[model samples]
Target: MRGAKSAKWVVGAVIVALAATACGGDNKDDKPTGAGKAGGTFSLGLVEPVSIDPVNAQESEGILVTDNLFTGLYEPTADGKVIPALATSKTVSDDGKTWTFKIKPGTKFTNGEIVNAEAFIRGWTRLAAKASASDVATPNVGGIDGFEALQKGTATTFSGLTAPDENTLQVKLTTPDFEFDVKTTHTSMSPVPKVAGAGKNQAYNDAPIGNGPFKMSGKWEHNKSITLVRNDDYGLTKAHLDTVKISILNSANAAQLEYQGFQSGQFDWARMPTAQLTSAKAKYTAQNEWIQADTSGMNYLLPITENGPLKTAKARQAISYAIDRDAIIAGVFQGMQTKSTTILPPSFKDVYQKDLCVSCIKQDKDKAKSLAAEAGLKPGDELHIGFNTGGGHEEWVQAVVQQIKDVLGLNVKMDAKPFKELLAAQQAPGATGAYRFAWGADYPTPDNFLFPLLDSKSINKDASGKVQGDNRGRYNNPAFDALVEKARSTKDSAARNEVYKQAEKLAMDDQALIPLWNRTQFRLVNTKKFTGGAMDFHEDPNLAEISAK
Candidate 1:
């Protein structure tokens, strides 16, 4: 969940919740029944991989593939914890500016290259190279001492990084970031063998070598499928499944096709389409093969430009209070997902400050109309709403459009574009006044949610001079930014969380963006064939952890 990756808009941006709140140790109810029989090909239906190159991959589909293919220093747990992966343990200096990682002994990449500090150095060197231009790694990599030099082609290695031995790696950051370790969990830090390394090279993107439980068995078929075989030489307890077949059924009816495959035993698992949820539940009511997860992410509607009718904070607040989150959940998601009252999920319940948007979530149409009138908007006025296609957003977007019309009496005329074109449009100057959006955490920290999407410093001007960040909304508040900056600089966890609460409250007061329901995922799995696999928010049960029953 780290790196500067932002490609999640194609799928849904998965902003992981802050550590100790929404992370790790969340799956206590699922008991481990010893690894079942090995040697079975687990079939999964997924969209085509955007890029198999771990460093360049940013979307959920690519992450799903690489999570099993590559290993990083840390990995996310179901309960929202960042636990050690490649490293035995990580230690921080008293100053909190330096970190020391104790590497696991005898780990090796799929290509037989020894996994060591130099491996990481080489991997990062490639990513930092000017020619590589790794959009996903640029931001956090800049946190390192010599990263600027590396990016500018003046240095061959990070000055902050040192390896006294193969087993020891030390890094010095430009600033003190206690939650920095969680950033290492991203695939950007996954060590790649020099021979198999390629940032945008088609060869490497086609079949990248990995150090995880599985390795690419063959070339990635264009818009079709990819196969992964067990990595026998992996250091950890080996993967149970002998192979994994990831098929790309890109039909507009892909979900239904996959579900049909599951019904016909052609596929072992599939995600239930939202459109078919009601019927699917009825058809499979007695079957206990349902796998559901409350993924760590939130959805909100953004006002991409400030020059339109939604320019006023009151107009924005009206929209925020206007969304009937409960009705939206029931109408759009069939009640599979729950309404999100806070930007931060309940995973961080202690600090989420659910009371912040109590009135907004109350669905009081009168308050919304009053807020609208304050913005000089009247009943029957047209409100422009924009969104991107793909990722099954149509059905839900339509439902949301209808909700605004029925509740607020506003004419919600939506401009829908393909994901890429929509992003481009959103970034264009004088573009959208209202845009549907979502954000997933780059790291498991409140800073990921607050700073990137809110802090003015993160904002940048596009070609058309339109300001953008993940904030896309162009929502800015100096007070909120100050609170967020304080939260970032503070090392005390309690103080930081409290600061975040205040910051979140300030943002809620502005009501620049409307919070929608936090989406849930439901995948149908063959229970008898897979015994120990447990699904979670970010991704499904790890392929390594799944076994034939």
Candidate 2:
């Protein structure tokens, strides 16, 4: 039921295609080309469908397209620094509860809609609307003043948000959030066409309007293809290519397509399969292609539920010890993954605790049995585990389940359902089931990693009036919640680090979740053709400066 914060690597050191195109003739010059000079069409492959609305899109590929199609009020720099995009400058109140932004002049949407303070207000308000069901805004912006109240039917409007003038916008929060600038990088906070925000329907979905580098030219849903043309009217800057096409494909077939050259010039770039890493290196290296290993951006795991046999701390710890992560990473993952000690990846500097727990680093079969015995579990006790097979990766899930059965004496039952159904079941209160899930950092903050999954306040009822199932296991500890909240409010690095240190300890002690391998970002690209901007979790396949050689 866990949503991917960004993208995933299909293989080791095999680069995922950001965008690619083949030209009729090769140009050996290494110089950059002018806008629209690279006239050929580029085709990028995505594993998942781009069904989510652009305003609330969460997938990495979706974000890449959205970035080219829209511009946010602010954009994150390469080093995770925030700089102005739509807004020229911003001022903060002495109390730190209010922020005033000065809108940049001459900013306009692709549909000729003027970019003003009112546009920002309208866009954010629409995102916070209950009808939107926007995953991006619900969890991130709910903390803003009057936002949660509106969602709960206690308030009719966002009293904290005000647009007093055409170019002046003010935002009031319930409390000061030091990471407000970082939070703005999310798509929910990005400005959208005022018309598209009117209602959720085909008009909004079919005709997405934005002020980005590219605009949607055509879409073929059944064929899984989207055509994007350069937004010539975009005032900021022009794109190098005239058109870019994105095609959705099965993960298993992506690498094969690249190797066969079926779409050779059309599919100049692709993510090489991990199984073919040795062959790819031998083949592509001779051609002088770029191949590198990028760190997996987040931690992936199968969380144990509190209402199940894993309710006991010993049982939960025992489950963690039962499966050998090294074997899973080597055999199932082909050494493309790294064992994670902390919930956060090593790429995240401020929040990741390097020395949290050394003993839990490796799996020990004897230790797992001893812990299960301590939990007072007799023979024949059933352990029910759930996983989403429709989202893909059924093989990995089956392997993990088999390993657990072989190592632990407990009887295990597996339920593999479609992602949507499994997600719904996971969120249903009193629904005790363990499932495979992964968490990617929304923003580069410890609070981002700790809050949504663990915080007690995050739990709520769905549209059906049933208890909303964020904390699927009903695992609640006020002390842990308080520690996370403290970290969220503090601006000091040392104070926030100390709070996260304590919070990590509490989470590990309860054994509510298992720490798995940290993911690495991998993408295959024709370096000779396109150039500029390094890839990162925040922005994959930096489209801003990419071009055809």
Candidate 3:
């Protein structure tokens, strides 16, 4: 696949915190049958999702809801493969610029509308339309031919798309992107009504239509709960659970509360909050039911570029080399996560190349001080660090501050801003000092992991050319960018891996970002009642595969 050309990125936020756990067996009027049985109910905990609209929702909190509510053209397997879902089969043309898909027979949305090629075409067209206002969505879909023009209002419709008949969908691309299947994992192709309504319809956002195994039973109650019932006509895999309830507990201590709720038998699945990990580990370990997997996103740090010492890569490397990742893991995360050296998560065993980051694997106070001095930094320099509004950042803030002070003799000032304000501040020219970076998979490919967030092409500019895209720090290097572009355009798996490894080394050598740790999902399922719940590498829980034990 010709890979990501996306300098412009789209909708989504990484899931930041873990869930809470509690203990007890609460009474219920009905008990579900064992795993593999035909019917039962399952409940899980969540922080509030921003939107249930498949095209608009970006964060994982919203994905959990949307994944259940709709099925995309392709389904991601737990191991990182993209296979057909709504699509019966897909084939690429000789030139690799066109793709044709065969829709599964008899697929229909909850509204009883046929999920034909036109349905798919309309969904894609609407997503790229000028009025969608889908900041989180437009970037992902705009890579298609003419979609970008449609979003820019230069074109009324995407000329790249055509549905010659009811069942066949054809797509023409401007470039040869072999990894296009990976992009299909996003829900931008979830077929909509023949005549879609205008922006943000309250009725449409809630109780939305889908062709997935489950259907929304009622309107989504923001920061409260969303209820779902099974679609008996779902054409693919059988939906073992009769119902699913997602409780949105937007409390300051939501993670801790989920701990208590799940232990009380209120939640069928929940995360073991880091706050209670120490206390719950012994008991949960004894039950032999706790699940732990490295959710394939990254927890890293970025340094802003416009004016400061960070403009010099040496200063950034000095900062990266001085930090103590172990202390953060021991103090803040309780030693559950694996150390990260690059943006690629350790879970992609074959794709991630070890030993790619130079002078970053271990803390070296002497080397850090030397590098800082070379970058023109003297003692008592006040370093400004920015973070989004939240409670859990205090310990991390304190740790990084103390580390910098001890190693480089620098003073640290922390800036806390609301989420919206933080995003704006980060994008402003030469203003954002330093901030954190967390990226969950928008797709399963390594290119999806490396591009947009780190590429030079993603750097936005005005008429005057000040950097703006998500590469907030403006870390631009020609050699690095070439390697990345080569990796994106290559088709052979071995060639892709070879080029990616080179790009990974080049990126970290420049200290594109200081990789801190791999995300670990502290998963807990009610073993007595629920027996099958698995998360794909993207961390989407497969609802169709879930069942009551």
Which run of 10 residues does model 2 get worst, by summed lDDT? 18-27
Cα shift from native, residue 103, model 3 (Å): 1.4
lDDT for each candidate structure: 0.68, 0.62, 0.67
Report RMSD for candidate 3: 6.7
lDDT of 3 by residue, 32-73 (tens): 223477688888777665567765665566666666677768
Which lDDT value does model 3 have at 161? Answer: 91
Summarize candidate 1's per-residue lDDT along 161-260 as a digit string, tens digits.
Answer: 8888998888888776677787777676778888755466778878888888789988899779999988877766567788899888665556677788
- Provide TM-scores for the models: 0.85, 0.85, 0.85
List the candidates ranked by lDDT, beginning with the highest: 1, 3, 2
RMSD of each: 5.5, 5.4, 6.7
- Residue 456, model 1: lDDT of 63
What lDDT tens digits, residue by residue, belong to model 2 across residues 465-523?
44342455556789998897777677776887888878977876777567767765444
TM-score of 2: 0.85
lDDT of model number 1: 0.68
